[model samples]
Target chain A: MPIRYPNGQPYSRSPKQGQAKKPLPADTYSGRGMTLEQDIDEANLYYLSQQRAVVHKKPTPVQIVKVDYPKRSAAVIREAYFKQASTTDYNGVYRGAYIDFEAKETKNKTSFPLKNIHPHQVDHMREVSKHGGICFVLIRFFQSAEVFLLDAKHLIDYYDNQDVRKSIKKTEIERLGHQVKTGLHPPIDYLRTLDAVYFNGDAKERT
Target chain B: MPIRYPNGQPYSRSPKQGQAKKPLPADTYSGRGMTLEQDIDEANLYYLSQQRAVVHKKPTPVQIVKVDYPKRSAAVIREAYFKQASTTDYNGVYRGAYIDFEAKETKNKTSFPLKNIHPHQVDHMREVSKHGGICFVLIRFFQSAEVFLLDAKHLIDYYDNQDVRKSIKKTEIERLGHQVKTGLHPPIDYLRTLDAVYFNGDAKERT
Candidate 1:
């Protein structure tokens, strides 16, 4: 028996799954164990503390139906439902640029499924990019602990042409996206990749 | 009997409340009746439709505690609590600039109380401003049907020096902030106010 994605595609293990790898330092933050959201949150906190960026994850949107206010106690939500977000998960200002992105992790090792990216999110990324915001997606391969910063334009292109292929092959992602380095201090240093891709590696030009 | 705020401040009517006012045209959108948040949402929608800007009100932050997954239905959240937001209510991008703001309204005609703002929000705005994002507060005076866009710096200054005055006088807001014009299509034309204040009345400089 093999695990399968919601779309019925069979999951396969990565070729390097059993290969020996270099061990991470004892002090490495998160140590490739935290979820992508947690890693990004840690990085964002570090960024804020250093005054390098002002990014934040939008709170989980919930459709609250009922709440009870008890005497001398805080209101407790009695009924609610999770609501799909209208925009990306993370956004903020960095170096006078509006930065927007969604972070997602895929257990599939061969390719990243298109089903993980919603239509509204693609529309949002397109709109943000059109408005001159730096838009991208942070994709993490859970099994291999590899993260890539794929520009929104590339994802949008592949998403719009999904009839040809329902998923983006790992090779295509490696070719088009910048690999994010994981280390201590701030687990995923995507900003360094952003500097290389968007700002032409010159961070002080705007300053 | 006068209405009172949550802080127990006695609210008073504006001096011109009883004066005869000019009648507005029947086509004015929202007609100064909607809440500040509604007006901003409407304006943001219009801006998006017109490709003028991309702004959105972040959803209310909720802490979801328990969820039940039924056999053939959407998951229902059974226990949750509303959480105070660490940042402002609204943020977006416009004209290659990161825009962040909080919208607040008060029925009191004389002053806008500092107590309406939270310290964490002030800290967030300060961080945003430090990162070169345009940060401000949209204040609405319900009694006068007036909306003013006050730069975050002004509010932060008064907030930090709160020992002198617990509230900012309406006159001070008028002196330091730009009055947002109300009209159809978009109920609040705040981007126009932003143009005058932050962009020096030039909308084409960046383009």
Candidate 2:
């Protein structure tokens, strides 16, 4: 299907349904055709065209060790390694405020494991917030296909007491988060929720 | 040889140097075993670890068509196409101010070609500056092993009259930018220039 925004600009889309199915693994999002990366990318494009806010996922860090150059056309990275990131996945400017966030998905339905998040990520989010930025997490429960926007301050609070509480219950997330229904063009449009919960309220209290 | 910082932190020499050289096409940094991507990555890490600033290369936008996962542990991207980016390469926060920039290198020693930078990148830099963020380009003339910090406003001015002015000459950049000497550890520490230019300037003129 041709995806066109309200402004008449042709929008880009990932491979649909069976076109990308060359699957060998069950849990890999890439095997499922449209990875979360693609969805978020499309979401950013939609946000940009509409002048909503600027958000982007930082690239995965890779440490390269060896390269073999016989012919100078396509350099092949012979040896490389992945490095863990200390910050959240997504960040940008929204309505004159800096926005920072991490995104995650879990197959389990019982609860969202805080273990999936790193302490360094918590520290990074805290730093962003301390510098006066909007920070949060976009969590998706795969089975239910339900997405939630949880504030970073809340996540930081739980993280500080995580040793005692163990994990954040799914029920608690459902209670605190603003539910985001996935859309067609931009599959995950969570910024709309930000407008209501953060902007509509008193700015001083939210900040 | 081992590298050490002034602060006594043991430093790993350029990870790019460790990679085996591969045959890549002419005008491709990848042919030498290191691409533009790796240089920016190293720069970002250096900026972060030193508490200087947070800057990262935006991910290479890819349109993934097919993926093959041979195992549950790894997902192989079988077929993907590159997409043009809408914004500059790097952006982040530093010392209570937002930072945005693009890094480009040219093999040409005489002049930096205008084609190396995209129009949207210039537009994005303009918007970033209007938003009160520090923005610029980190240009490296690889042949001469020299890097220069050209402010975004200067670039935008030239970019606007590109039809008449054509490319930006090296002498012009030399006159406009502060030269950055590459070191063993972080390689390019341009933050010190920023400290002297933006942060340490008279307080009232800032912002």
Candidate 3:
């Protein structure tokens, strides 16, 4: 029988329970069990440890409704619901420039669907770009285990132009976006691409 | 009689339930019902509307342990716990520069206690500053309704110096930090203070 919570409702374990318990292999580049979010988190940690950049993934937004404060214990969140995020998932400072981006992984092989990104997120990326911040989207093709860093300008143009196709073709992405190489130290080394595209291959020169 | 949740646990209202329902006064400078967080949020909204800056408060972090997915409805988080934030509460981009800060309100009349800021936060701020982000803390004296923007450098200096006092004296804060004036539009005009100190009173010039 399924476990029941205090209110008589059945309690269910998270879908990722089995995967979370599984031990990671010695090599992550194989990218078998690791998710794109986890890869980026590991990269961010690596960046922070080296004092290279200060990027972080924002916490998941939740609308907390009820909390229980028991004696001699931490407050327990009894009831809550997830809320849509207003901004991108990741942001940070890189070489005195404000960096912001969203990461998404798709199983499709030929193209990246536009449905993965929301309208508000496009507007936010546009606004961040207008304010002179380095804004982009990191798209990973799960089938090929490849990642690409596409600047927000290209994304905003496609999002705003009604005549264009709904999804961006893999060929077009190759032409417009820079490919991010995976490595052991930092799973996704997108900063190397950023250095070439935005900072003229030398971050110190811009600052 | 109190309401009972599905698990037979009694549901108690949040501590801020009463204040959440109260209407705000027309004049916020009086700050009768407004919290420091609320005032900064209002200011951030104002900044976003004007296309001046893109600052935001990171959402509260929560660890969801159990969730109930009722068919055709949003998933309800039944069991969770609040997690401590790893970084400062607020951060954003302004005039092509990275900005980061934390806000705190003190009811004390003479001094702002140092215990309010955690050691890890100081370390995080130090890391941010080293990475070239404009970092600071917003200290508000609840009794006086006055707010000050203290640079992270000053706070770091005091924190690292073991011989110094435990709290920052109001007079010392007045000497080192710039006073943030309250205005009708943004409520707390911290950007103006930033303009004077960091941007030489002209944000465009720095950009």
Candidate 4:
């Protein structure tokens, strides 16, 4: 069998690496630090190299309306608009299980606000899970550099009971979620916990 | 359930309509032209409103390195890099099943060229099928305006045999594919086919 690359692709990584190295970010984002997006991107690389599982963050969807071609080599977007996404931030296949998730980082140390997640995404995860897909969210507290993977079931439960509150408490997240320690390559190996949870049926072990 | 806007968000359609009217073609590259993406976008709106299922096009992922805050109202991306996406162009849940596929339009009249598709997408769809997800591609011949849904199983088969010949014959796609007739509300009612294939157990219909 041919080796499947991340995203179920079979291209040489060197090309992708070359594309990734093209002076986009000096160090992942506007100098505050590596944004949560960057951290998970590197983590995806690590997971790919070790053949852990294939997961990726979907790119920010920007609507490019006008492009100026001073030269055919360069396509500069002149007039474009940003669109809101309907699904989660990340989703991919892992160990023959469809794994979908959204990653959010909050500044508030006490709790992660539900506003960070859109309701359409909440509906999406619910539908995915109803169909037997494994869905969750990877929450990071950037100030603390702590990561937690909260299952979608918990999220839906919280979302359904909106009459209660506006946020998911950090303490509750810590208790109900699995912690993902950041690493060098594939910085966020949240799938390790996914395997132990969904596939292995030890999802309750996190509690 | 609260009403979801066109992009699957639980919001009013006012913002999206205002955004879509901005006349930027960057977001219009779904290759359907202004009317096409709008049709599908509208179709998605109808589907969501009716509670059929949730589906959406994956956003184009970009790595932003430098962003300039010219004003408190808007932030401009000064420099950014394109990232490789690891999944298909579209994915979502329908009637309790995971649906993933890429949409492609070809000008060629004789054959649907495999080159129009990336290897990574093939890998992603294969993985999606492996995980019990519903996977397929929506192929349209703009000259004829004929839309067909070809199962990923058949697509991967033809893709794997690419060494022999590098194209999917029109006859082949027609023989193995299911045609999607355009409809009101959401222009492309492919979800009807999805319900037929996934929930009603119509896989044998194509076979």
Per-residue C-alpha lDDT of model 1 across residues A1-207, encoded as one tens digit per residue = 889867665664432343212222232223455767888999999999999999999987766666777555457676666677799999999987899999988878889988888899999998898888899999988778899999998999999999999999999999998899899879999988888888985632222
DockQ of all models, two decimals each? 0.27, 0.21, 0.41, 0.18
TM-score of chain B of each: 0.81, 0.77, 0.82, 0.79
Off by over 4 Å in 1: A1-32, A201-207, B1-33, B201-207
For TM-score, the strongest prediction is: 3
Interface root mean square deviation per prediction: 13.4, 5.5, 4.4, 5.3
The docking category that best describes candidate 4 is incorrect
Best by DockQ: 3
Q: List the candidates ranked by DockQ, beginning with the highest.
A: 3, 1, 2, 4
Q: Tens-digit lDDT track for model 3 on B61-133?
A: 7777777776655576777777767899999988888899998888888888787787878988988888888
Comparing candidate 1 with candidate 2, which one achieves the higher DockQ? 1
Tens-digit lDDT track for model 4 on B1-207?
Answer: 898656564543343353422222221134345445555667776876777756666666665444445432334454444455667877766654567788877777867888777788898776667666678998877677777889999999989999988889888999888888875556788987776665575566322
User: How much does each candidate deviate from the true structure in C-alpha RMSD?
Assistant: 14.9, 9.8, 7.2, 10.2
lDDT of 1: 0.81
Question: Model 4 off-target regions past 4 Å?
Answer: A1-35, A48-52, A81-83, A95-97, A118-133, A142-144, A156-167, A181-186, A200-207, B1-36, B62-66, B78-86, B160-163, B198-207
Instruction: List clashing residue pairs in candidate 1.
Output: none
